[model samples]
Target: MKLITVIFSVFVLSPLTVSAAPQTTSGEIRFIGQIVDSACEVGRAGTLSSSESRQIELKPGLKLDVDTYRNACSHDALPMTMTFEPLKTSTDKGIVTITYL
Candidate 1:
């Protein structure tokens, strides 16, 4: 009788102990944005769908050209400005300061 009681208690309490595992209460933030030159905007402001965004794959340490995405940009769209901001100047320096226009 005692053996049966111990087995039943073990089975019931095992699940309760497992279910009490710690859970994180924090939330996640996702930001998706794209930049284009004025010429590209004039010719065609391409749309980046969520599915396409997911399909884009970049290899580590590989740099991508913004012109690749600016397919509709005019050939005359020269002297474009591409600013990669919020970049650290050095390991000792913090995030780059940005001044919005």
Candidate 2:
């Protein structure tokens, strides 16, 4: 279970407030249960430069769907590598690679 996370933030100052969003950059977001860990390899990781820091915090709650990785059903259907549109209307794309046991 992996999710491409789009982080957003908000700030408040005595009833006046400002909002900020996570700068979106193309990257490979890996999902494990409810956690979306960022890539931490040497120099081959995805883009995080355009990603902006946040001012406000949010409840950590987003789970990548295993069903979202399901391939199209058909008689001759092969194991498929597929991705989907992001949830909460922000994610542009998602991809899933299936591994059998």
Candidate 3:
């Protein structure tokens, strides 16, 4: 009878002791990004300056016209053409063309 009781106690207590043991999980997380030219905000008359760094969010269909002075600001303003195309996923494909003029 004592042997049976001891066997039963061991079977039940073994699981409890095993479950109480500490568990550890390890992995790695990485972040990737890029540093690009800041956006230049134009004036009310639609003008941009070399000193200004403005950020603009482009949607599917939007157009903008901007004019800037030559080497007026620390950051010389440059003309760029950006085209956004929709892809199969939620992300979009952007095509950027920079012109010296």
- What is the C-alpha lDDT profile of model 2 across 1-101, one tens digit per residue? 12322222222342343223233348754443552333221111232232322111111232232221222322333333333335565664333333332
Tell me, by lDDT, which candidate is best: 3
- lDDT of residue 72 for candidate 3: 25
Candidate number of the best TM-score: 3
Instruction: For candidate 1, give the lDDT of residue 94.
Output: 32
- Pairs of residues clashing in candidate 3: 39-54, 51-73
Error of 2 at 88 (Å): 2.3
On TM-score, who's better, 1 or 3?
Answer: 3
Off by over 4 Å in 2: 1-79, 91-101
lDDT for residue 64 in candidate 1, whole number 0-100: 25
Candidate 3 total steric clashes: 2
> If ranked by lDDT, best first, what sequence of candidates would result?
3, 1, 2
Candidate 1 positional error at 55, Å: 39
Assess each prediction's global lDDT (C-alpha) against the native.
0.38, 0.29, 0.48
Candidate RMSDs in Å, in order, are 15.4, 23.8, 15.7
Give candidate 2's whole-model lDDT.
0.29
Q: List ranges where model 1 is wrong by over 4 Å.
A: 23-101
Residue 33, candidate 3: C-alpha displacement in angstroms: 33
lDDT of prediction 1: 0.38
